[model samples]
Target: MPLNCGIVGLPNVGKSTIFNALTSAKAQAANYPFCTIDPNTGIVTVPDERLSKISALIVPKSLVPTTMEFIDIAGLVEGASKGEGLGNQFLGHIRATDAICHVVRCFDDPEVVHVAGAINPLHDIDIINTELLLADLETVEKRSQRVEKLARNTQDAKIKTEASAVAKLKATLEAGKPARAADLTDDERTASRELFLITAKPQLYVANVDEAGLANGNAYTEAVEKRAAEENSQVVRICGALEAEIAQLDPPERTEFLESVGLHEPGLDRLIHSAYRLLDLITYFTAGVQEVRAWTIRRGTKAPGAAGVIHSDFERGFIKADCYACEDLFKYGSEQAVKEKGLLRSEGKDYTVKDGDILFFKFNV
Candidate 1:
């Protein structure tokens, strides 16, 4: 399954501008609202400095980086749950994503119109979140009604479990809390996934600030950070207009620009890393003389399941994995040195993968 984050926000909040910067794609960005009706998706590489370090040390002939997807969905409006302004289509696109990247307008530019008629980050957040909450509320209500009836009639444990999950979801949504904040068991969570609740997905906020707001956050960004902290989520501040300009530069020019700007890397890099973490993703590496590649896996994924990402046959004939931490290689300067130091180990199927692991899978098939 492709792990994707849907970019959502009110109109003219720089969602498309950020998307275009992240992917270097020509997604239409206009001063007006709803310029993007259909979602524009781009495959974005998950930047990890470790990947390059590994390639440099191993001196591979080819290096491949793992990637994720980003979808720029249509702008949302108030009463979106009630089918206002392409609401149904927008909600569908969001439901299809694995996570959400909410873009909040933190910059005040009188030229670009704000859909909510002013520059209030908190209000913008509320409008978008309220619509998603309302949509999820409807989904849970409908599911609860059906599942409750079926649970009363049938003796199936699965039906009973789903009914219980639906009840929890209904109560949470009615209380104005997101479905994700609802207390659900493992089985309940699995059951809830079938409903594709918009509020249930992991979310982070992107504060679209201007050039002045980049160095020290403006009041709008401070408000956003406070809200994100309350929800235990993170906020990444980016200057969308500036990032777009940086994206257009060549590699050498880009590096120079970043240095001159007193930044280690582009803001989009932080955004991508935050999104990857929000989705609970980790990267492992496979190194050889011919190629060094990075593979993405969910956090706490076991050896066999991770092997399956490479090929189905690998998992079917799974034996063990030769795993070593990439950090150990950085410390020791060679894989053979890692083995001598006993950092490398033969991991079994029960072994869980860790971030920055360099793995060599061994299977019969």
Candidate 2:
């Protein structure tokens, strides 16, 4: 399954607007709280210039780009963890995603109402973070109740280790820190995945600014950037209203509109790529006469693991991969040129796939 990033923020923070623009899907972008109660999911193609570049060289019949899922989760209110304003339902939706895109309202328009009666990006971030932390604290506390007994009464080493990990997580949450903030060992981190704490997922902040703010970030965006810097998180600034308008245009018109706005590319493209990188995702390609296709995998995926992304049978019967860096192809201008320079490699099962590798997996079922 493709990994997903959940769009979340307080009500009327342009989460739906950004989602609609990102996917070109008509999610209800009304001017009120909880406009989107149910999550709206859209599959977005990860844009890669290399796909077309490789296609140009291979002259393939078809070109397919890999896709990632984006889910527009309902706006989270202040007391969402306590079942306020469908908060429980929304939190569940967020917990299911691989990553989070926290959209913060950085633009001011008196015409549109703010849920908190004013715009304060830092305050808004704190409210959402507190709720998520509280929700995770509750989860850990409840799990501890059962595990504590097992650890103390039984001689099972696994249960004792889990109990200790749970205790560490609880302490961190109680201290108003996210679950990801806790220092965990590799084994504990792997085990904590089963807990599925919402705060443990990677996150990026989206600053929804006005047209003017897009060029030079406003005070609100500056505040967001400061907070993100302190947390070591990434912040992406975009004009939600303008992106919505751009999303409605045709291809030619969109190009013209972007040029008119003095932007080389739509901000949504930058936002998408930022979110993709936030998840530690990398793209590899399979170049063939039949097709030139892009594929998504984690950064350090081995040959068999990368093959498993294409097909389970391929991984089960994996041999080796005939691979060449896309850069070599671009530099040498042809497969024959790359071969002559010995840039192509036959990789074994233990080979870790690189981002722009053009691979042809050799397998026997």
Candidate 2, residues 136-247: lDDT per residue as tens digits?
A: 9999999999999889999887787788889899999998989989988777787688899999999999999999999889999999999999888999999999999999
The CA lDDT at 100 in model 1 is 98
Q: List the residue pairs that clash in candidate 2.
A: none
Query: Could you give the C-alpha RMSD of every candidate to the true structure, in order shown?
Result: 1.0, 0.9
For each predicted model, how many residue pairs clash, with residues at least 3 apart or on different chains? 0, 0
**What tens-digit string does per-residue lDDT give for candidate 1 at 1-365?**
55999999999999999999999898999999889999999999988989999988899999999999999998999999999998999999999999999999999889999988899999999899899999999998888888999999999999999999999999999998899999999999998889999999999999999999998899999999999999989999999999999999999999999999888999999999999999999999999999999999999999999999999998999999999999999999999999999999999999999999999999997
Each prediction's Cα lDDT score? Answer: 0.94, 0.93
